[model samples]
Target: MTRKIGTEEAIKRWNRFADAYAANHTELGDIHKEVFLNPAIFSLIDTVKNKRVLDAGCGEGYFSRLLAKAGAAVTAVDYSPRMIDIAKERTPDDLPIEYRHGNCEDLNMLEDKSFDLIISNMVMQDLADYEKAFQEMHRLLTDRGCFIFSILHPCFITPESGWEKSKDGKKLHWNVDQYFYEGTYEQKLGERENMLFFHRTLTSYMNTLMKTGFMLEGIIEPKPSEEMLKKYPSFEEDFRCPDFIVFKLKKR
Candidate 1:
């Protein structure tokens, strides 16, 4: 049986893996972010000039810097202290971003109705108690405020899902299993770190967001654009299966 771990353990693992994880991220974030998530996220976002934005679970703060450059008043938060440190280090002094060490599930340091937009990119599946995190996001946003987030697609990236490659290392179809299992599972980030992830069904995610008073506005299962494909032709296989899902929600 897979052991169930809590949020604290998850954050600890992130702290330990912070350096390796941040190493891969550039100003545009990692390759995955550059190719898939960033396009989908920025497309969903409205004009951010002079708007207040909160980057929940803002890893090493790359997105925060991007938002600030786009003229948003950005407050970025991460549960891992090491991540926050790296984010602060990477951020330029000219960029006006407030980096805080806090969990998305419980951000009492931030006041209510404090932001115009809240973005949690590639973060929802990392921590347990996503319902609480959703509630906290709703609480932090003003009425009609937008919340955008992305995650590994629940329909495809399950705990036991990967490519079903044939012999001789030929390309093959993707494999997904344990879609109903809702708990903690570990996956390796680098050679040494076995990162923890929380899995939930698609229905659970949508219903919980609705219950948290968010009206779903848009969703994108990002595919590499022609430009991206030209840069990374390997992403052409992304047409076969979606690796990530992005959502845009409005506070109601």
Candidate 2:
């Protein structure tokens, strides 16, 4: 879980995990599908329906396919070409979704005022230049357009503090206190081209958003379900610590 995020490492790991990541969720494991398509985020107003939408850092176009299904002019972009190819293959014939191979930070390929809604789903954590990405989203959005995005909640959630079953059939807790070490890390693989999420403080996130000309509209803190609590007893820890956070934003 304490692996590095980068283009070199992620290009291969994501390719290897692309099939699985598409089939299942990488962070929430399909339990919280609403993280990407929540009513409060995408459907809060009259934006998605028949509106030109941009899904930046779209991995395999899951939300892009959903937006297309909802009658939106969708243009999905990702940093990985392999991801774009897979996304193109997965979209339905009449979805009207256009998958483009582009970096999230530099969306110069898209003209100004090209989309009504620009969505970046759980991908902000994977980018190093989010300030530039925010600037590009502002440039791409219509005069009153919005950019809704989701990311790993940095303040409370740490990737290394996860629980997995050991061979001895005992539940062991990992005490990985790597928060002090805020630097790039690579995966077990030899590649190192992906962007490992550098967790900034919550104040940092909000300040950055305000500095980038975006107004925070709504926030979604999704919790595990009752079934999940019954199935996995350890999930109740979220009562004290939440896991995921979805945010809604508009051009300021």
TM-score of each: 0.98, 0.77
The parts of candidate 2 lying over 4 Å away from their true place are 1-13, 25-29, 32-47, 163-182, 185-195, 225-237
In the range 174-252, model 1's lDDT, one tens digit per residue, is 9999999999898878677788889999999999999999999999999999999999999989999999999999999
lDDT by residue (tens digit), candidate 2, 212-233: 8889888877666676678666
Clashing pairs in 1: none
Give the deviation of candidate 1 from the true structure as CA RMSD: 0.8
- Clashes counted in candidate 1 amount to 0
Cα shift from native, residue 49, model 2 (Å): 1.0
Instruction: List lDDT for all candidates, in order.
Output: 0.94, 0.69
